[model samples]
Target: MDIDFIRGARLDDHLTIKTYISEFKKASLTFAQEIVDQEGVTIAKALVKVACIDNVKMKPRPFLRLS
Candidate 1:
């Protein structure tokens, strides 16, 4: 899936947001670990939009998460 993000922006997508948010959290954890390995705790924020592709039979909306 592809993603786009901006600060303080509202998202319209509805479906697949939960799973996408989980995956995004994992990825972010990895990144944070990379940084924390060298330094102490660091503050960071993230905004992500993931594409949710659904078949023609079902309607799907994209997913967005901010953390």
Candidate 2:
């Protein structure tokens, strides 16, 4: 999984966080998220990607087919 932040967020400020799943598959998922202040200003943004992997084989995990 990888995460990147575009800006800094402060703890003292009231913030609203929203997230969306941009892509989804059996083996991986991609998401986009943002943090905004009460004034509707964007405080931070992030992109996340999660992938399924097999630790023992050190390779990507295969997706199961549904009937």
Candidate 3:
């Protein structure tokens, strides 16, 4: 999994954050998040990508089956 922050936010300012799944699968998920200040100004954005591996030796892979 990897998380990247695209903007900087102050530590003392009140923040509102929201996250939503952009894509989802049995073995993986992708999401985006946004952070805003109290004034409703966007202060930061993040994209998170995650992959599932069954074992340590197994390479990362995507979802193969859906239920």
Candidate 4:
């Protein structure tokens, strides 16, 4: 996961977080995310990657079908 802090949030600030898929692969997924204040000011951004793995075999595995 890689994160960049654009601005600091104050104690009284109400924050909202949003995320979406940026890329998809057979065994991995990448995500784009952001944190914003009540007024829609961006406070931070992140790029996160996650992988599907077979724990028993200790190897990569394909993601399950959504539908």
Candidate 5:
């Protein structure tokens, strides 16, 4: 929305665009496994995707909103 953010988003988007979907999917699953182990609960795959997307957008644990 702001200049700095716009520039950052452009940078991040450029970098993100280079990522292979399969790799992202693999990493997301691996990360979700760690979260499941730490939380001691099985999380739905959709949640894992959401969490992964949120994280790539920016780390979510620090300011996680369930909705």
Candidate 6:
């Protein structure tokens, strides 16, 4: 995970978080995320990578497709 802080959020600030997939692989995904204030000013951004795994087999697995 990597994050860059563009601005600090104050205690009274109303913040919104948005996230979306930036890359999709056979068994993993990379996500892009951002934090913004009520007025739509970006305060932070992040990139996160996550792997899909089969719990029973303890191995990498392809992500399920939703209808």
lDDT of 3 by residue, 6-29 (tens): 556777888888999988887788
Worst 10 residues of 3 by lDDT: 1-10
What stretches of model 6 exceed 4 Å from their correct place? none
What lDDT score is found at residue 29 in candidate 5?
32
Instruction: List ranges where model 1 is wrong by over 4 Å.
Output: 1-37, 55-67
For candidate 4, lDDT tens digit of each residue in 23-63?
A: 99999999999999999999999999999999999899999
| TM-score of model 1 vs. true structure | 0.22
Query: Candidate 5: which stretches are off by over 4 Å?
Result: 1-39, 47-67
Candidate number with the higher TM-score (2 or 6): 6
Better of 3 and 6 by lDDT: 6
Q: Which of candidates 1 and 2 is the stronger one according to lDDT?
A: 2
Q: Once superposed on the true structure, which residue ranges of model 4 sit more than 4 Å away at CA?
A: none
| Better candidate by TM-score, 5 or 6 | 6
User: Candidate 2 lDDT (Cα, whole model)?
Assistant: 0.79
Local distance difference test, candidate 4: 0.97
Please report how far candidate 1 places residue 9 from its true position, in Å. 24
Better of 1 and 6 by lDDT: 6
Could you tell me which residue pairs clash in candidate 2? none
lDDT of 6 at 56: 100
**Candidate 2 on 1-67: residue-level lDDT in tens?**
4445556667688889899998888788888888788888887777788888998987888656689
Query: What's the count of clashing pairs in each model shown?
Result: 0, 0, 0, 0, 0, 0
Cα displacement (angstroms), candidate 1, residue 22, comes to: 3.8
